[model samples]
Target: MAPTKPLLLDGSTGEGGGQLVRLAVALSAVTGQPIRIVNIRANRTRSRPVGKRGSVHVTGGGLKNQHVAAIKCLADATRAETTGLSAGSATLTFTPTLPPSRLPRRPLKIVPESDASSAMLIFQAVLPFLLFADVEEGQGVEVEIHGGTNTSWSLNYEYMDLVLLPTLEARFGVRVERELRRRGWSQGPAASGCVWVKVYPVRKGESITPLQLPIPLGKERDTRGPRDHFEVESVDVALVVPLRLLEPLQTALARDIAGVFPSAPEIDFRVVEDSGHQARIYVLLVAKSPTGLRWGRDVLHSPPKGSSANPTSMADALSRLAVKQLVEEVDSRGAVDVYLQDQLVCFQALAAGRSSFARHGDGRGGGVDVDGVAGAPGPTPDIEGDGLRREKTHEPFGHGSMHTKTARWVAAQLLPGVQFFNKGDVVEGAGIRFA
Candidate 1:
């Protein structure tokens, strides 16, 4: 029998990057649904300087090497049928292998051509399948990928290792690990990198758990807005820098981070070999909360032009970026960081139960997790949202408001009955299942 026609998506939706495509493919694999996306990378347009710096010309919209590479990797993962799977193609179709439970037995490998391509983006694209992969007892899926580890617009491996995965372990019960075999930078597409990941499948009959937002110690509802009380329990910062700036940048960053934490959280700093062709600085900030989970943000050092830049500026730039981001995230009052918020949207929706978390905002207040005692905010599969719907508002759930908006937009489009609210930052999953 012919497969049902897939859901058609507007590639211009949300941020118009590969996110919508990734979400669509992941869900399609799980739900056994086919999806077709038109106008790939429609949110972006091709632009080049016509002459002077101030002058530029728009040459219409198109897909980039990274976008093409991402979709291809995902297509290979599910052994899916696809059309328009080449660079610059504007329309794409994906038909997953039937039953939505089949996965590769051998280690899956995907490599990028340029250094600027994000391995993290590719990893993020395929992670959902790994989480729910079907494997024999004592067996897990292995993925080996090559791309930039520390790049703009994607989470670094450290964030995944120290922060994001840890949160998954604590909150969602996912068992995963990462091994960095080589280092890659995002200065441009020519730079190269490598990373390996092993995701242990959940036991038979077990399902992914939902995310739950904590209420306050004595409060009925959370009112913390964007900034809330998330105590910093630990701090792990890793730096891979050139030999010339190693000691200086390391020492300077450590001192700067000290002032950010008044409670004297456990802080550790390490200096490692620099990766890639050019000398660069990489910083990973993994902040943990005893009452909640880990929140991570990594800052890539902007290379100094000529001989004018010094060690102080390098350390200061990343230090400022790291400290300021952590503080703002703590204040945001959301359950996860803005970046992590994007990562979790798909998982929360795919899981089998109810999940809730504090929404992001700039105001102040408090709340606590009431799950264990109350057995979560509501029942499994469907959640009731009283806040403003995504279509009706512009408020973001967390960081990169547009990104959170994008995730919600993708979910709403692909998963019917899945709704996200503005004020509450609460989401109702589509109750997606593989059986």
Candidate 2:
């Protein structure tokens, strides 16, 4: 007889922003647990037509169609509709088609209509599941995500490369091969982009040894200009639009990048003319990392009125803003440092051994904090056999093993035999772990 699969419940699957969906899908893939969600994107506005005539042309339509296993409600209707998901903006219900026993059963297939945000979210949801899928010694999984490569409300290719990909590879030991087939943008449906991701899983999980984060190298000065060591090499800008709007976007971005990085020789930008009505801009910022971080950002707004000097003025503005943010974070000493703190959590759990991170106890005086206490014996009986045991402690604890402490009271949870600590001291999860 087949074993009964445990159901993983996501309280806010659709709540908050897209994070809920992304996290749920990622964790589901990691834990090999099937999930059923009731309120998908409950906080988001229902799908709406991008242009006039109530014609649905947005990527949300693609999402609604692709995941037919999940049912959604119209804002006003009592019954859910598989067809015409645009009846009215309403809540979505997602139920996985297969059980955990059947996951990674086949490479997941998703075809999004040039909607980068939706496509990325779908990718986040399914990628983790694929990573954990059962593969032979040398088998790799492939997923084809179709959408606008450069779309508003989505992390352009640059961020996926620099920020997202680097962090994932470093922390989770996940290696992926990606190829961008075509470019899609929000100028209209005319700009279509395709990308394929090949995922290779780390079978034994990350090394159990503790990690030691290196201090960031200081800023460097070059003959061309004085820039942060983490400075963006060049932004590969692409605008997918009608022939008329093409020149306008190019001129605008060139001007903007010149202003931002005046000393740099010139901004390396490009344009792809595919569809006339739709226009999207894709910017890939080449970083100076050994593995060359690729950060992508795009502008998917409507064409500007009165070509007066700057036709793609809005696109220029948004792109410049994104570049500024990316530069600031990459250059700042604190950005990657903060991320390292958060990312270590998953690795700690996977290590099946205690791991530590260098962090200040009270926001002062840096020290190493032991994150996972799995090796320590006998706080209680082994409950799940996932190396997780609960223990009753005289301190405050947070959900899952994260904790904080105060002098007044000791708050924590004892899950049979699990042990938690903070600053080399035992603490509880009363507030730190839960909200």
Evaluated with lDDT, which candidate comes out highest?
1
Query: Looking at candidate 1, what is the lDDT of residue 323?
Result: 80
Range of the 10 consecutive residues with the lowest summed lDDT in candidate 2: 406-415
Q: What is the TM-score of each predicted model, taking all chains together?
A: 0.82, 0.55
lDDT of 2 by residue, 205-273 (tens): 323232222323442334544343234456655545555555665676667666665335246654455
Indicate the TM-score of model 1: 0.82
Candidate 1 yields a Cα-based lDDT of 0.65
**In model 1, how many backbone clashes occur?**
21
Clashes of each: 21, 39
Off by over 4 Å in 2: 1-15, 32-36, 47-108, 112-117, 161-163, 190-193, 204-278, 284-298, 305-323, 327-333, 336-435
Clashes of 2: 39
Distance (Å) between predicted and true CA of 217, model 2? 11
